[model samples]
Target: MFSFAISKSERNALFHRRETMATRMFLNGGVYSMADSGRLDARVEGLTIDPVDGRVLAVGPQCGPVAASDVLQLPAGAVIVPGLHDRHTHWLFALFANAVVLGGVKTLAEAAARIEAQLAEQATGWVVATGWNTGLLPAGLLTQSWLDSIVKGRKAIIFDQSFHGALISSTLAKEIVSKFPREAIGSYHDGVIHEQYVMLAMAWMELDDWTLKAALLQRQIIMGRVGFTRITDMGVMGFPLLHALQDIYRRGLMILPCDFAVQPWMLREDPLLSATSASVLHFQLRWLKEFADGAFGNRLACMCGHHRYSDGQGGKLLLDERRYVDDVLLARERGIDQFAIHCIGCAACEAASTAFGTVMQRLNGESSGCTFSFEHFETVHPKLIEHVARLQRAHVRIEVCSQPGFLSDLTDYTDRLAAHVMARINPYGDFRKEGLAWRAGTDGAITGDDPWGGMALAVNRGGEQTITVPEIMGTFIDAPLAVNGPATFLILDRDPFAHLEQLGQVQVLETWIEGRMVFHRRN
Candidate 1:
């Protein structure tokens, strides 16, 4: 249902066409467009928007002969900036995942109260929930017996903090094993189902089209509240969720745009893949994602030297080199040009880099117009950088999608490696110098998906590798509010550019997508 242009010529035609009737104009606001550090400049007076295409028709000082009917007069001294983009997040999952969220619950009693509340409300359905931090409930206490005592055999699944896996009650586990015949998912060691295998176990849980619509509505509501006009979801699973998104857009209920990665194995029957389409305005299914290693809390983060959970020789790779390479190359053959690999540990990072290098080599020394990103590149290593540099030399672009909020909320795995070692390993400054592109992501659903908060965390890291506000914002923002750009932007209460310390405190008074106001704070 999305109407985006794929080719450069098509976009050029859209941009070059003469402006149509300016249906709306945002008047009397300080327009602040961000650019690279070198160009921290420029201010505009207003923007005239074309309703038909949802793009800016005119810029500053182009005072209109248009009628006053379309004008939206700004409040005294309102500041209009570009709408925010969360380069990496799970906006869909943030709303649709578990009805009962247990994030930040440090005590078992608190978790029980929430579960019982959900039980009393739903009555008969499964108590599907996520956000069970290993630190919140240590491995020893995270057991079937422990959960059975609380839920009393009611169908319940308390997934990990990241929702990568789940700890199911015996009742639900039995039902899952009976339905899905997979050894990896069936064997619930310590009552924990690992990574992608949990997807197989989740076959028992199903939602109707109406529920998906409601979830989609909630997803947009939160996006507006958080000032995010665009989100890049890590991965989107199943055909129903995809169709639900399309149906929402068809009904004019979609307020923002989303670019998401897909798991081909999950979408094997999808006609969208069969069409081999790259993307439209709202949805992008060209990127394929895979997890090279499990999460750190699970002690399955493949690392070197010492790890508290896995074998001393370091953790293990969820997808070994050969399998990963085969899957990537196969997806590439099917027109998947973008690939996101989950690499939280140095050992996992190394393995992914090597496999990607093989992918490049298979292309006969060319990158083959493919992109590789390391999601949550938490612990970067010099050797990993060297591998990246080699790939870069061959024109293979590598992106690091980092979640700074992890530093604030999740610090349980910090002690596993020395501070100095990690500091020396994750040389972001050097990465920048070598022309490696990086972006800040909130890892939403895992952490709060606020760009301002993400900027604050990066600037306030209080370490040698700490980045400046300009450094982080440069990832998504650009200057001067280009005329042909989509009319997606935000309205803030004050001049966000000047106040560095108050970055975290800045509030989004309004959020607009394609010139239409989607979110207006009612303060």
Candidate 2:
């Protein structure tokens, strides 16, 4: 097997500098800039950007000197807003050409058709897909044999929407079972693997650089189309994915900024590249990622009482409480300043928080300069919320990288989770009421990477959890879109505030990263 290697010349080429220019661009529009105290600003008629470096020159009441030749007026219906930042995403597979998405399949016949079509494309090789929503079909209907029947001669694996488990066909099972640990037997189904085994399943598919290139090509088109300017990749599994991205960035193909996670699994496969920190100009390995527990759809998000997935045995923690505490210190040793732990269940959340507290206790009030981000913080028992707040006081910098898209998974939380557990599902309002740090992400594992689609979920969620359009938009933009910030933003076709109910219909006319226009909707 060929390893990903970069020569001295190639490494130097990654940072070749260019002279900066003073070219400027001016836009005349009714802009909703985060500049005015982060409140949905009054109609700002002028916006200026230094096109050379893509930094905002001026906007709203702070409009500075402008040249008449620079003004570019948008169409009458255009609505300008700050570019979206997705806090969590698996960038590699978001648009992988071969990785078919089953998020829309509503029936077994539909799923079968998709698998067969993908198999037909290749005479031999595995057909990998993800985003298999459990609500689409009866859970009993999807099994290894059921998947095998879809494409008899080919190897196949369809990962569940939750990204915590999967159903593998027999042919692929033979390839994955040998190394599969016997003690880690799965509980979801006959041939289904859950928790860390999902990583093991993906490891079976050794994607080459060529396969990855096809997927990398979709990064700009797909991400910009969905209105994202900066994406924080949750973590990528294999070496080829990161290497493929590095190659693209080397060739000046990267269109936007991304903070890629340096996952623990990558240390064994690509330690040199993983430790380098800066992979390319716009992509950096800034966050170290790990899983704390399984997810909701798998009936495995460690609950307290009898929920749908458990009777009394609340789900699972990927590691014991002691292991998590050790890992926190290990993260500090690795020089990882940012840590993202995946936790969905209340018990899982508690375990992760306690581990952070343990490390702080050992520090005795010394700051390690490391921040902790909890991914998929969908549930937390009311009592544990205060403990989390106290941990923050003790200097375990905490933030929730939440996926609002998961709200679509459950129609009525009361019907699925226990009475006590259901109320806490994505309790954003509670987080706000208690002053918790939180941000939005389109997980892409279970949902598509559409900021508007995710925002629509929050807007329509009406009740304590429902957030005003501007407040939810803040989660995507990071802060007020003030001067000197990156000239990355979007042109929506209509006013968002006026049509909050129709957010799903809002169209992105253009997406600009820096001063460059990356995506323009075809007329």
Candidate 3:
């Protein structure tokens, strides 16, 4: 069912042709051309590509003639679809794929054992680990003593699955408390790190550029293997990371096209913009990232009502209203086209909407070229939805970038917080009814970053607010392939439409970017 038509010699020949040939023809596949209306057009049998420029030159049965050497015939039953895009994801952090992953550990003891093993393997430095859920622990909390027992007073930080906070060893806490300002250290409770502390601790143990570049390349290959051709990095660190990505692109090592949203703090602290024309392959610095609140899983999301497990208290707001408004205005004035604000709770969503309103009113509603997005618009209160609809009616381009996989990830938690939170998490149907422009993201290493898993979650929604396959697919592949468009696409082993329920199980035979085969399944 999953096979490559090109043998080893043929694959080598094709790679050689990629450098020498001006044009290439990909034939014998079900090519789903994207329509202007954002729907898949009828499948074509062939596509002619200009390999040098990485664009689709022609399509349909009557594609112009090409030499036999230029034709790369696909295997039987191959299905070619337009490239996929994740509108919001942390690209740099996703590189932590190599870090000690502990997503499905059942107990704190299990987590400790895993951390102990990783610490044993590493010779020196902090032993960082991630993806431990307190809910899974018997004590229902990650205490410093527990981490200290395993880390043996060594510097370590174990991030929760939500990534809103972490569990730090006492050795790391003492170092932070001594060196950093009390405010910068944020909250350290029972061994858990919160807010600015998480950022500061990560900065302290930041990976070297060489290690980061290697991890980034691994992440890109993983993305291509999962059918992502373009991604919008929701919160990219400025300067060093930006420069590193530029170098990666210049060396022709970058696999996918990336658009970055610089952290708002970086915009203020560094205040430098790289030349966009330096290299077309370079990652584009696009938007400013502003966090309105934290995440729901960690009880840090700024909610209007009480958290079910907590002492009837709402979540925390991370931003000052006046500063948030001023920052948006400043970014717009500085020529940024978009501002992405992370708002997971109703209170945070309302606050961000209000800020957008204030800034738009000040600009006399002249926000045609600029847009604002509420990342993880998770909770849907009637008031928040109504307010967002009103803002949309007022010509404010307020889009939402939601992670449907959160539904699959938070199903049990949602049940526990049922009385306190909205019944439906990520109300895609409600968003559609309200005529809100929205896109889906995986949030990466934080959640499982598989797009097919995301698509499955969007369609099923665990029987709460389901959407049709096409509607869900739109969020993954928003645009259709066209002439002069970036040559990016996925070759699937089975037709997705015919195997809707098994979408996540569908194998990606190959992924092409800019007319070159970036990934191929090793049969």
Please name the candidate that would achieve the greatest TM-score relative to the true structure.
Answer: 3
What local distance difference test score does each model get?
0.64, 0.68, 0.67
Compared with the true structure, what per-residue lDDT tens digits does model 2 show for residues 1-523?
A: 5444546454323322222354677788878887664467456766788878878888753356656666677888787888888888877563346777787677888888887788777675678888676655545777778887777857777776565677778887777777755534234446676656766666557565655664565655677777888888888665656667777776666656888786555553444544355467887777877766644233436321112344333434555656555655555565566777788777667666766666567656554677777787877766666656665666558777788787776652334566566556778787667666668998764567787877888878878877778767878884445688888788889888778778877888887777777677771
Model 2 CA RMSD to the hidden true structure, in angstroms: 5.1
Q: Quote each prediction's TM-score.
A: 0.84, 0.85, 0.86
Clashes found in each candidate (C-alpha, N, C closer than 3 A)? 1, 1, 1
lDDT of 2 at 514: 76
Q: Model 2: which residue pairs collide?
A: 34-480
Q: Give RMSD (Å) of candidate 3 vs. truth.
A: 5.5
The better-scoring model by TM-score among 2 and 3 is 3
Candidate no. 2 TM-score: 0.85
Candidate 1, which ten residues in sequence have the lowest lDDT sum?
Answer: 302-311
lDDT of 2 at 77: 78
Candidate 1: stretches off by over 4 Å: 1-26, 35-37, 57-59, 63-73, 91-98, 178-187, 202-204, 267-272, 275-281, 294-316, 365-367, 386-394, 410-417, 421-427, 478-480
- Tens-digit per-residue lDDT, 1-523, candidate 3: 2221335564343222235465656555678766545555356777777777888877666367777777777777768887788887776674365568777777766787788789888767778787665555532445788778878878888776666577778888888755544433145556666655666566566556677676676677777778887888887654556666777776556747888786556555554553243224647777877765643233435221112233232333355656666666666655677878777777667666776666667668576778888888887686677677777788667787888777676643643455446455787777777666678899877666688887876776655467877777777883577877877777888877667788777778777777877777772
